[model samples]
Target: MPVQKENVSTAISSDGGSGVSSDRLQAVARGDNIPAEVHKSVFETTPVLKINAFNLWYGTKQVIHNISMPIPRNQITALVGPSGCGKSTLLRSVNRMNDLIQNVHIAGDMQLNGDSIYDSRMDVIDLRKRMGMVFQKPNPFPMSIFENVVYALRIDGEKNRSVLEEVCEISLRGAALWDEVKDCLNDSALKLSGGQQQRLCIARAVAAEPEVLLLDEPCSALDPIATGKIEDLIQELRGQYSVLMVTHNMQQASRTSDYTAFLYLGRLIEYGPTSDIFTNPVLRETESYVTGRFG
Candidate 1:
C-alpha cells in the first residue's frame, strides 16, 4: 500500500514530538534568517557535487538564498518543494543553464567533482558535457533512434560506425528500451510513444557517459504507467550514475530517492535520508509539507 501522509504524522507524534513552535514556523514563513536544518548524514556519503552558499537573482529579485548541500555520488538525491520554490532554478544552476537568461546573477559556487563550476576560465560546453539533462517533457531529436542515441558521440567527431552502433545498443539497453526498439533502430524517434520517447531521451543522455544525470520533473508529463517505468529506470541507475532530480511529487520523492532535500522560498530547509524526512523530520513545517497538510 502507498504510504499515507497521516501515517507519517502518526509515526512522529508517537515519539512524543511536539512539532515546530509557531514562532519558529512564523519566522520561516516570513523569510527570516533561519539556518537550514541539514542532517549530518548528508555529509557521510561521498559527494559528487558540492553546492556552497549558492544564491541566485533575476534582475533585482533574489530567488535562491544561501544554500549548501552535497549530492552524494552514485545515489539519487531528490529536491522536493512546492511550486515557485526554486527547485528547478537550483537544479539549472548546477549546469549553468541559468546563464542563458539575461540579467541573471549568482553568488557563491558549485563544484562538480572538485572543479569549480563558476570559474572564469571554465568551458561551459565541456562542463555541460560532464552532465546529462532531461527535461519535463520527452525531447527526442528529429532523427532516427540510432542517431538520437549516438548524437553526442557524433558531434564529438566519432566516425567509427562500429563504435557508434555499440554505444547505441548499450545505451538503449541501459535505458531498458533496447528490447522495444532494437528492430526499429532506423525509425524516427518521434514515431515512438510518450514513454518510449522519454526512455529514448534517457538513452541519449546516458550515451555520453556523463558523470551526473539531471532530471527536472522527468515523469510529470507521463501517465501513471509511464511514470512507473521512469521511476524504475531511475532506481536502476542508482549505482551507475549520480542523479539529482527536482520533483513535486512527494510520493515519488519518498519512493525513489536515497536523500531528500526540502526547499522552501528558495532556502534549504531540511535534508536527510528519505525515511527520516518523511517519518521524523526535525521541523514541523517539513512534516506539514510532506504530509497532505500544505505545500
Candidate 2:
C-alpha cells in the first residue's frame, strides 16, 4: 500500500522528532510496496557501481525488491538495516557470490564501470577478480602470512618470488599491517590476534588490486579496539578504493561511510549522503530508522 498523505501529516504533527507513525513502519515491515525515496544528491557523485531495478529470490521467496542505487567511486557506501533485510544479499550480488546458493535467482542489472554484471556473456571469474570481498569474521587461510597475502597471485600462476614479495609488502602496507608482521611473514596466519587476522584478510584482498572492495561486517566479530582499528583502516581506504559495506553499527556507518542506504523488508527506504540521511532525511521513515525510534 502507498503511504497515505494524512498518515504522514498527522504523524509529523504528533511527533516532534522522526515524525513517523508506528502504523507506517508496520506497513513497511509487512512487505508493502512503498516506493523508495532516493535523494537527488545520490547521483551527484560519479558512480563506480550502479544497481538498476534489482530483484532477487531464494527459490519462490523474494528477498530483494526493485532496489536501485549508485555506489560512488572511491568512497565508502554503507548498507544499514535490521537483520534479515537482504543487506548482505545485495552486497554478495555485486560479485555474483549469490550464484553459489541453490535455487537463488536475480533479475535486473548491476553495472561495474559501465559493464553489465548479470549479462550471460560476462565472465564470472573475471568479474570477481575486479572485486575483493571480506566476510563477517576474519577468514585468513591457514598458510603462512606471506602465503596468505599472495594467494591470489599464486592462483594466477605468479612464480617470481620478487614480484610476490613486492606485492605482499605493498598490500600489507596498504592494510596498515606491515610493521607488525614484517619480520614474521612466514608465521601461520591463524596465530595472529583477532584484529590482526582480520587486517591480514584485508591485506589478502588488497593484493588483487581490485576495482572495488566488498566488506560484509568486517568488524562485527572483533572487540571494540579491533573494530576501531578496522574502522580506521576503512577511512584510510577512501579515495583509493570504492567500498561497498554492510554494517549494523550505526555509529560506524556514520563515522565511516560517505553515502548511506537504508533498507527494510527487502526494500530500499532511503539513500543519500550520510550527513543528510542521519541529520536531515527526506523521509520520516529514514529519520525514524536512523535515530533508533523504529526499524
Candidate 3:
C-alpha cells in the first residue's frame, strides 16, 4: 500500500525556537507525492536533522518525492532500498553534494539543528563542515596517513601542529585504526589495505568534529573481515555522533542501525525502529521487501 499524505501543514519546535513553517515546505514540495507522517515514538531524542516536505529533481525528472523524517541525535539511521531507489541521492542531499551535478533542482526544507540549510543566507561550506561524508570507495589522496586525517582541519585554516596531531590521533583511534597506523603516520595512505583505507576515511571525516557522519556503503567493497570491522566501528560510533548510512545489505541494516527507512521508486514506503521495520512492518510493500518476496 502507498503512504498517505494530508495537505495540512505542520510546525515543530527545536532548541526552544520555532521551526520551518509547513506552508513553506508545502510549496516546496508542490505537486510531489509526500509520504505518510512518521510516528512520534520512532524518534527517541532531539532530532539533529529534520527534512520536511522535501523533493528533488534533475532537470525535469523527479528523483525524490516529498520526504519528511527526523534523524535522531547520536543514533544510527540506515536508509535501505534496491538500486536506483534514491537512497544514495537522499544521502548526498544531506551535505549538498548533489549540487555539483548538472541541472539539479530541489525544494522543501532541510534543517540541521533547526536552521534551514537551503536558506539564502546559509553558507554551503559551513554546512558541509558540520556533516562528514564517506564515499563507497576509499579514495585517499596521495598523501601521508597523518595528512589524510587532518585534511579537513588544514583546509579550514588550522595551523597549529599540536592541535592537528592531537586531532589526527583521536580521530584515527575513534575509527579503530590508530594502533595499526600509529607507527607509520608518514606512510602513503594508498599503501594500506582496502579496509584500513576505509577506516582512514572515517577518521578523516571525524577530524573536523562534525555533528553527523554520512556513509554511502562504506563497506560495500570489502571482504567479510573488513566488513565486520567496519560494522564494529559503526557500533562504537553510536552515542558520539548521529550517523546516516545508505546500505543495500539488509542484514547490515539490522545489525548496525537503531532506525531504518525504506524507500522505493523515489518515495518513502515505510520508516520506524529497526526492529519493527525488519520483523513487523505496517505496510505490505515493506513486508514484501523485507521478506525477500519482492524488492
Candidate 4:
C-alpha cells in the first residue's frame, strides 16, 4: 500500500476509538513545559486517544494506512494532508461517522480508557457524546440560540430547567460566545453572524461535556479575524478538553496545535511535537511539505 493507503474502515465494523497503539501512541511523559529530546520521553503513562493497526475502505478504495498515534489529553492535535488524502476520512473514523456511508469496511482496534468502542456492546450515543464533532459550516438549529446549546443536553435526559440553563451558560462561555449572546438567549440563532454561529456550534458540542472535540476544517468558512477568534477559543479549550482538527492551512496548524501529524496519501509520514515538526522535521516528506517542496 502506498503510504498506508489501505481501504477506508467501515464504521459498522469499527469501534471508532482513536490512536495507533497503547504503548506507541500514549502521550509523551515527563515534560517540563517542554522537552529537548523527542524520543526520550517516549514512554506514556496517560493517553486519551489510541488506535492500533487501523485500516479503512470506502467500498473498494482504501484511505488510511495502518496508522497509529496517541492523542495527548487536553491538547490540540492537527491532522494535515493534501486534498483527498483521507485527512477528513481519518477524523471521521474517530467518531464513527463513516458508518453512515453506503459501503464501508473497517479493520483494526481502537480503544478509549482501554475499552473497545468498536465492540457491538458499546453504546453509540454515549460514544458520540464522548467524541463531539464541529463541521466546517455552522449548522445551528432553527430554534432560539438557547435551544441550540440545550438541544443535546435535552437528549441526554436533562430536563431540569436549572441544569439546562447552567449547562448552556457554561458551554457558551467555554466556547467564548456567552457574553455576545447572553442578552438575547431567546433570539433565533440564525440572526448571528458566521463566526458567532460557528462558536454556537462549538458551544453545542461542549454542552455534553465531550472528552474529545473533533473539528473538520472549522475555520475555512470564516475570515481572518473570525479565524483568530476560533484559534483563541481552541487555546482556551485545551486545558479542559482534547481537540483534534483537520486543516490544510499549515500556518493554522503551526499556531494552534501542540502536536502535528503529517499524512501523505493517507499514510502518516510523521507525528511529533509541533515545534519540531515545523522547525526541524524528522521525515523527508514532512520537510518537503513544510518547506514548500511538495504536498
Candidate 5:
C-alpha cells in the first residue's frame, strides 16, 4: 500500500463550492472534446475531488492498487471495470464507506476539495455530507418521500418546517422528479415505482448539498426509460456537482462521462478523456472491453 498523504487542499473552495479559489474556468473553445485547455480547467475551475496514490484493502487482502486520478469539477468521471475489478470498492473508499464494514482496512489519500479523507482531523460526518453517494439499488428509507429527502438535513440539525419544505422542493426539482412527485411528497417512498424510487434516492443525495456525488451502478436495476431519466438528471447536474460513477455498462460510460477510467483485476488500466477511450483506446484491455470483445 502507498503511504497516505497528509491533509491538503486539492483546490480552493470558492463561493460555488467549486473547490478552486480562482474564477478562470473559461468554457473550452471548439475542440474535439476535452482538450489540454480543458484539463487545465481542473486547477483554474477548481476540481471538487482528487485521489492520489489511493489504495485499499479488506483485512490483509488488498482490493484497490495505487490508484490516482482527478475528478474534474462539475463533470462526470465514470469508473468502468469488469466484475470484481474494484470499481465499487474504489467508490466506497472515496466517502470512507468501507470504514463501516468490519475487517475492512484502507490505505489511501482521497481528497475532497483539498483535504485528505483519512487525515485524523477529517470529520467523517462532515466529509460524508459533502460527498454523498447513491447506491446500486434504490434503498429509500422506510419513510415518506419528503422525509427521505429531509433525513440528512434533519440530522444536521435543520428544523423549521418551512425551511425543510423549501429545501425538499429544491432538491426534488434538481433531481427532475418534483413534477412527478410534487403532489405526493407525503407518500411512502416504497409506493413509488422503481424509477421514481431511484430518483427519490438521488433527491435525497442532492438534498445533502454535496460537492461530489458518487454513484454505484445507479441504473443497474432500472428499465431503459428510467435509465434515460437518470442519465438526463446526471447531465443536468454536471455544472453544479462533480460526479463519479461506477458502471459496467460500456455504452452508458461512453454516453455520460467526460472522463473514463477502465479498471481490470484491481488495476486502473486506462484513464483519459471519454472520447479517446471510446474512439481510440490506448490499451489492449480497454479496447477489448469497450469494444465488447471480452470483459
Candidate 6:
C-alpha cells in the first residue's frame, strides 16, 4: 500500500489531531520546477542517523508528518524551511528534547547507528550524551568560561583537573573560541559578547565528544561576523562529526550544507544534494521556495 500525503488545510480530526496533507507534499515533490537532467541521487554510504514514518504532536496538533530521511555520517545536512514548519520540532526530536514539553507525543522510529532511540530500555541521558545541541541564542551559564566548557564532564563524575583542562582547551579550539577566551578562562561566561557566548556554548557541547551535533538556528541572533565564525566552525567540524542544522538563512544553508532538505507546512517537500536542490531542484515548489518566489 502507498502512503498518502495529508493536506495542509484539512480540518481537525475527531480525535482532535491536526493531520498533514500528503497531497500538498506530493504536489510539491512532483512539481515542475526541477530541471530534467537532475535526478535524486542515492548515496551508497551508510547513515549514522535515520528517521522512518515519524510523526509528532503537541497535545492534538500534529506538527511533523511521516518524515523519513537518513543523515549521512561525517557530513553536514541542513534543514531549511519557513517558520512553524516543524524544523525545530524535528531537530529536538532526535535527542528527545521534545520530551521536556508538556503533552508532547511522538510516533514512528528514530534510530542512531541502527538502534531504536525510543525503546523502553533506551536511556535518555545516555542518548543525549551521544548527540550535542546548540540553540538559536547564546546561553552561557553564570559560571566561568572554563567551567562552562567542561560542565558536562564534571556532571559525569570526571574529577581529573588535567583532563578537564585538556578537554576544555580542545573543545574551545574546536568551536573557534580558544584564541579569544584562552586568557579569560576564569571570567564569567555571561560577560562575553553574544558571538563569544554562542561559541562558548558550542565548545561546551563539543566537550562531551558527541558523535552528532544538532544546531537550531545557532546564528539567527548573531551579526554577520559572528555568524561567519560559527559557519567556519561548522565547516571545520564536518567529517569529524555529523552536523544537522536547521537554518532559515538561505545563504547560510547553501554555504554550509552538503545536502539540504526543505520543509513546508510541516512536511518534507524536497531533499537532495545542495548543488542540485539549489541549482536544479526536482520540484517546482522547491525551486520557487529556494528562488524566493514564495515561502
1-295, model 3: which lDDT tens digit per residue?
4334333433556665444334423433464454553555776568999988888999999989888899999999999977888999999998899989999999998999988988989899999999989999998989999999999999989999999999999999999999999999999999999999999999999888888899999999999999999999999999999999999889999999999998876777678888878886665456556766545
lDDT per residue as tens, model 2, 237-280? 99999999999999999999999999988899889889888887
Q: Which pairs clash in model 2?
A: none
Looking at model 4, which ten-residue stretch has the lowest summed lDDT?
23-32
List residue ranges in candidate 6 displaced over 4 A: 1-43
Q: Model 1's lDDT to the true fold?
A: 0.91
Q: What is the C-alpha lDDT profile of model 5 across 165-278, one tens digit per residue?
A: 999999999999999999988999999999999999999998888889999999999999999999989888877888999999998998888888887656666677788778
- Local distance difference test, each candidate: 0.91, 0.91, 0.86, 0.78, 0.79, 0.83
Residue 266, candidate 4: alpha-carbon lDDT? 61
Q: Which candidate, 4 or 6, has the higher lDDT? A: 6
Residues 162-252 of candidate 4: C-alpha lDDT, one tens digit per residue: 9999999999999899999999999999999999999999999999888889999999999999999999998888778889899989999
* Better candidate number, 5 or 6, judged by TM-score: 6
| lDDT, residue 57, model 6 | 90
Find the candidate with the highest lDDT and give its number. 1
Candidate 5 Cα lDDT to native? 0.79
lDDT head-to-head 1 vs 3, winner: 1
TM-scores of the models, in the order given? 0.92, 0.93, 0.87, 0.85, 0.83, 0.87
Across residues 1-295, which tens digit of lDDT does each residue of candidate 6 receive?
3222222354345788644333345554553232122224535556889988788999998888778888889889999888888999999999999999999998898999988988889999999999889999989989999999999999999999999999999999998899998999999999999999999999999899887899999999999999999999889988988999999999899999988998876677777788878887655556657776555
Ranking by lDDT: 1, 2, 3, 6, 5, 4
Q: Name the regions of candidate 4 deviating beyond 4 angstroms.
A: 1-45
Q: Candidate 5 vs. truth: CA RMSD? A: 13.3
Better of 2 and 3 by lDDT: 2
* Each candidate: RMSD: 4.9, 3.8, 10.0, 11.2, 13.3, 7.9
User: What ordering of candidates by TM-score runs from best to worst?
Assistant: 2, 1, 3, 6, 4, 5
